[model samples]
Target chain A: MLKFSKSHEWVKEDAAIATIGITDYAQKQLGDIVFIELPQPGAKLQKSEQLGTIESTKTASELYVPLSGEIVEVNSDLVDNPQWINESPYDKGWLVKLKITNHSELNSLMDESTYRELIAKESH
Target chain B: MESRKTPLYQKHLQNKGRIIDFAGWALPLDYGSMLKEAKQVRLNCGLFDASHMGEIEIKGKGAFKFLQKLTPNDISLIAPGQMQYNLFLNTSGGIIDDFMCYYCDESLLCVVNSSNKDKVVSWLRDNKEQGVELIDKSEETALISIQGPSSSRVIARVFGEKIASLDYMFFTKKEIDHRQVLISRSGYTGEDGFEIYIESKDAPYFWDRLIQEGEGFGLISCGLGSRDILRIEAGYPLYGHEINEETNPYEASLGWAVKSNKDFIAKEEIVGIKNKGLKKIRVGFIMDEKALARQGYGLYLGRNKIGEVCSGTFSPNLNKFIGMAYVLSEYAATGKTIEIQIRKKFYKAKIAKYPFVKINTKSKKEV
Candidate 1:
């Protein structure tokens, strides 16, 4: 099942592992991605903590952890090919694989419909 | 206060430009990818609606002398049809603003940076001598630019060969759609281009004509995002970033703009600063890492902080991250290495000479 955060991060859960990446809406707003800094594997992160940073040609934006978890793996390929995030924010562009530390934290995230409504109001 | 929209506002929407509030003016940041737009300028042509830029007219016989006192550059060096880059320096040797003046023989037309219009106008009036009529025409005038290598070809297709070959820095008055428009062979980008001044009421028509005729030559509309990157790539100093009220001309590596023979504002102070040397010196640097060294970032030599970055960006032409930084005079030298502190980590960068890309401007002498 897919869950989302208000900060534009998306998470797809399978058993206890959740795949995380930014939304297409977020990537579009950023315009272009030039470079990125990802977190190391096995790092313990809490809910709403800064996870990584993405740099566009214009400016840099920090990515925040949507839920508490221990990072299992990160997409290291994005370090050399950051533009891939802009090209595919959902599939190959997945940022980190996290083992959910708190199952109740997933309840705080929004569904697809709720995330769509949030962005729709932001455009106005 | 509400943000002011340029006369080309609707046209920007029609072209699908991503609008942003820049210096209280609603303008296009980019259409989509600023990198793509920047790359296009190097290969072909690009259009820009610069209507938000400020224009001022100095009338009467006192105009020439007023210009002499206002700027550090020698006005007499330029001919009637030519223009020169200039700086408005205060008595303390600080740069109040940077502007360009077109020598019109009868009167001089000055284009000031948009954000500094109010300040520049007040300064001009405060120092107003007799017989000089300082008229601010910024509200009525609109600026449109065609930039890049293919600029001349697109201009030739519409404005004809005579206008296309007008040489760098020179301009001519032409009647377009029964309205008088001023076309100058100049631009912020180092590439060959033309900056056209038209009436605000006629900007849309002017933009449409250029975009339509330019289509055959691969000219696309560009935004301020790419413009900034292009100027920095060419090593041009921006008013707020590389220059400001605190930084003096000599410290900014703009000593060439100051005339030794002519008397102008802050001439004495600038000459003193040049002879006494400066504490800080501005230099351009290319990053050795993928990380960007942004403005206000600290520069380091070993463990000591030496200076700060003023402007930073990724150059599509160079295919690397680059920026301009001000460092201690002792540490500032070409080929010297410095570390930029980003995210609490130090990344190495090499100081290099700029106009990072080869200048493509065609001068009158070259013609």
Candidate 2:
């Protein structure tokens, strides 16, 4: 199942583990990604809480967790080559892999179609 | 209150520009990506709609004399058809605004910051002399800047050979597409370019024509986002960030604009401050970490709170985070290490000389 947070982070769930990254719209809005401060593996996070920071040429934005979980893995490649987020946000730009603790927290996030509609409304 | 839109608002909307509220004006933050636009300005050419900037005309028999008294720079340094970077100082020797004063023979044209337009007008009016007339031309005037290394080639292609001979800080009046405009060889990007001032009504058409003609020359439309980054890379100071009513010219490293011999506003205080030397001074620094240092972030030398960042950005050219801060004079030397407290964590940084990227303009020697 694929879900997105209001803050523009997307999560792709496989079994109880989910991979998290910013949406294409979010990367586009942020411009060229220069630096990203990611939470380390084993770090605990709450739903909608600031998990990390993403810095672009213009501004810096806080990255929010879509669901409450413990970080299983982080994309360490982003530290030296942050532009991967801009070049291939969906694939190589995955920020973290989290082992979801609360399955009910997933209900709060919007599904793919709903997130598309939200972004559509926002663009207008 | 609703923000006023520039005449090119529709064009920006059509070009996929992300509109944002900037100093009570609706302006594009960028057309696509600020990083791309900033790179384009450095490598090729970029078009900028600077219509939101304010222009005030001071005309009369005592126009030159009144300007001499108003600005910190020596007004006599620039002749007709030339412009000089100047500062408007308050009674307390603080910066009111930094402007470009254009000497147009009979009248002096003052190009000021959009955010400080109303305040500048009021201040000028209050200090009005008997013969000088202060007229706000901001609403009627529109400014368009074509900036980059290839800017001269693009401008020469459209406007003709006349612009080719125009040196930096020089301006000339010309008619383009049946509209009379003032073309000045000046820009904020620290690049070779031209700033064209035209009537607001002619702006849309002129913008379209430039974009259409400049397409062959690889000129792309840029926005304020890239402009800010470009200026920061060039080590140029913005009004509210590097200077304000509380910050004096000496501390801002703008002492060159103040003519010590001239009898201007806050002359004695400014001269005294210059003689006494600055306690704190503005310096550029590069962060050791990839994380960005932002404005208002505190700068510290160990545990001592020395100063704070004024302007900060991730430089596209340098591929590093660089920023300007007003630090204690003792720690202002190049290569000095400092720490910037960003989001509760202190990041190591070093004071460095700027322009972080080498300036490649036609008048590089002059700068």
Candidate 3:
């Protein structure tokens, strides 16, 4: 199942492991990702805490964790070529894989349908 | 406060430009990808709507004399049809605004930053003497710029052979689409480009016509995001970032615009500041880490904060993080090591000379 945070990060949960990345809407808003600082594997993260940082040509933004977890795997490819985040934010651009420790925290995040509606309202 | 829209606001929306409130004006932050737009200006061509910029006209018998007393540059040196970059300074040698002055024989045109329009106009009017008339033409005029290596060809296609031969820093009045307009060979991007000043009503038409004709040459619409990056790469300073009412031209490395022999506002003070040397000077740097340094970020040597960054970005062309900062004179030398505090981390960096990207501007003088 897919879930999203109000801050624009998306996650896909397969059992206890969740794959995460920024949404397409967030990538479009950021405009041309040049660099991304990804959290290292084994780092413990709290729900809604800063996970990493993403930089475009003009500005930089902090990436936030959607749920409390420990980073299991990080996409190191982004360090050399961050444009993948802009080209394929959901698939090839997945930032990290996390071992979910607080399963109830997922309840606070929006589902795909709710996230779509939120973006639609933001555009208006 | 509500933000005012420019004449091309609708067109920007039509093109899917990301609009943002910039200094009371609703302008495009980017038209899709800001990096792509910035690269277009470096390799191909980019079009920009600069209508938000303010234009002030000074005329009458004492117009020339009045301007000589207004700006720090030697305005008398520029003949009619020539333009000079200048700074409007306060009595203490601080810059109020940096502007371009165009000499039109009978009158002078001053192009200033959009945010400083009211402040500049009021300053000019307050200092107005007998025989000088000041007219604000910002609302009635629209400014457009075609910038890049291919800009000359694009402009030549729309105008004529005359535009191809124009020298840098010179302008001429021409009739385009049956309306009188001022075309100048200058731009904020450190590329060979032309700035077109026309009637506000004709802006939409003018922009559309250029895009249509320049399509063959790869001309694309750019926004403020790309504009900022290009200027930063070129070592050009923005008003609020690199200069302000408290920042003097000397500290900003704009001493060339101040003529020591000329008598103008803050002449005595500025001359003294020059002789005393700058306490802090602006310098460019490339961060060793991947992180981008931003304005107001502290610059440090060990634990001591020496200065602060004014403008910064991840350079698209250089493929690295670069920025400009005002640091103490002792730490302003090329290759001088420094650190920038981004968030809680301090990234290693080194001072370097500006124009981080090589400038490709045309330097041919008119015979």
Candidate 4:
């Protein structure tokens, strides 16, 4: 199951590791993803802080850290192939791998159902 | 997604244009790959649906006098059939919009961006004095642009050899799509191109005919995505990015377009700004790295922040990052060292000459 933040980031957890990327809604709003500046490995992050940046033809946006964690790895392939984020945002588009800083913070995020509802509301 | 169709929307769709909404108007950014479309226009020829943009006809006896007061440029210098690229200014000397004014007989056709249609129309309508009538022909008219190195050959093939004889900034009336049409030798991309104006009903036929006939000459239907990269490479100004209500024309490096001889809207303020000397100027930069420097990215001179990138893109032609920014006047000269902050990391860049690539053309012909 995917957990989502209000800012449109999605995260999937497996034991102690979490994989994260922006939601489909975010990609659609971005139109076409031209470049993405991913966070560096070993960088520490706070909840809701800007983690990286994404650019499209018309605009650019800051990707937010959904929860506090230390980045264990980043999807370096995106540096050369940024369109992967737009193509497979949920799976192969996983932006970063994080070592969870606070386990309880994950509970604050919305599950798939709740996240879908939020997107529906945001569109209106 | 909600798509806003222009007057020539169906025509663009029929011409095999990959349609997309640009600033609420359903327009073709390109018919195919943007890079190939751009190159085709540069090497051979390409046609574009520019009808999504707005065109207002200001006629009546006082049309010229009214425009002189409405625009920042001197309208008196523009003779019949001549056109000039100019800007509209607010009271504070900020750019209201960038536009091209066409002098057609007693009427002047002002072509503007799609997003600024209502705003520009309202501005002109509000300022219309006695003996001047402002007509919004945007919905009734359609525009198409055929551009590239082989543009003359393509135009001569369709509209006749007379089109090849048109001088820069001049337009002529010709028959296209079975209707009387206006063809002008002007374009946004720094290339030899022709802009055709015709009735909306015949736009679809005109677009299809041009694409079908120009296929051998490498004509491609281009979209907004590629257009952005091309214009950015050519170092032209986009309204919201490069020139806006907060930025003055002089600072945007449009001081050459401003006429000092006559008094127009915000002329005194512009003259005052000129006397104080321009504090900042728009300059082009090419990045050394493959990374793109997007709009609002802070530009740095060593460690000090000097300016910010207004527009940037990955030039498909040059296969590198190119951009424009407004740096401090002292660092505005070509070849100055500058750095852009992309994702909080500074990347090295250098201020370069305008038109990242120079387009060669033989345009000695007059209209």
DockQ per candidate, 2 decimals: 0.80, 0.79, 0.77, 0.18
Query: lDDT per residue, candidate 2, B103-209, as tens digits?
Result: 89779999999999999999999999999999999999999999998888888877888875699989998887799899998899888889999999999988988
Clashes of 3: 0
**The candidate that achieves the highest lDDT relative to the unseen native structure:** 3
Q: TM-scores of the models, in the given order?
A: 0.97, 0.96, 0.97, 0.78
Show where candidate 2 strays beyond 4 Å. Answer: B364-367
Which 10 consecutive residues of model 2 chain B have the lowest summed lDDT? B358-367
- i-RMSD of model 1 (Å, 1 decimal): 0.9
Q: Indicate whether candidate 1 or candidate 3 has the larger DockQ.
A: 1
- Reference contacts recovered by each candidate, as fractions? 0.77, 1.00, 0.92, 0.15
Strongest candidate by DockQ? 1
Pairs of residues clashing in candidate 4: B29-B222, B29-B223, B29-B224, B30-B222, B30-B223, B31-B221, B167-B366, B167-B367
Per-residue C-alpha lDDT of model 2 across residues A29-123, encoded as one tens digit per residue? 88878888988899999888889889887678999898999999999998988989988899999899999999998888898899999999998
Off by over 4 Å in 1: B364-367
Worst 10-residue lDDT window, candidate 3 chain B? B358-367
TM-score ranking from best candidate downward:
3, 1, 2, 4
TM-score of chain B of each: 0.97, 0.98, 0.98, 0.94
Residue lDDT tens for model 3, B194-309: 99999999899889989998999999999999999999999999999999999999899898888888789889999889899889999999998888888999999999999999
Model 4 bad stretches (over 4 Å): A1-124, B11-18, B361-367
**Per-residue lDDT of model 4, residues B1-367, tens digit only:** 7876766676667766767677887777665446566666677777777787899889999888888886778777778988888889988898889999998986999999888989998988878799999899888888888878778777887888887778888898866546989999888787888899988888877777787778888887777777777788778899999999999888887887898887788888888988998888899999987678878899998789899899888776786778999899898888877889886578899999888888553443322
> lDDT per residue, candidate 4, A1-124, as tens digits?
7999999999998887889999988876675566788778899999988898887654678889998999999998987777677788897778999999999999999998998999899877
Q: Model 1 residue B87 lDDT?
A: 89
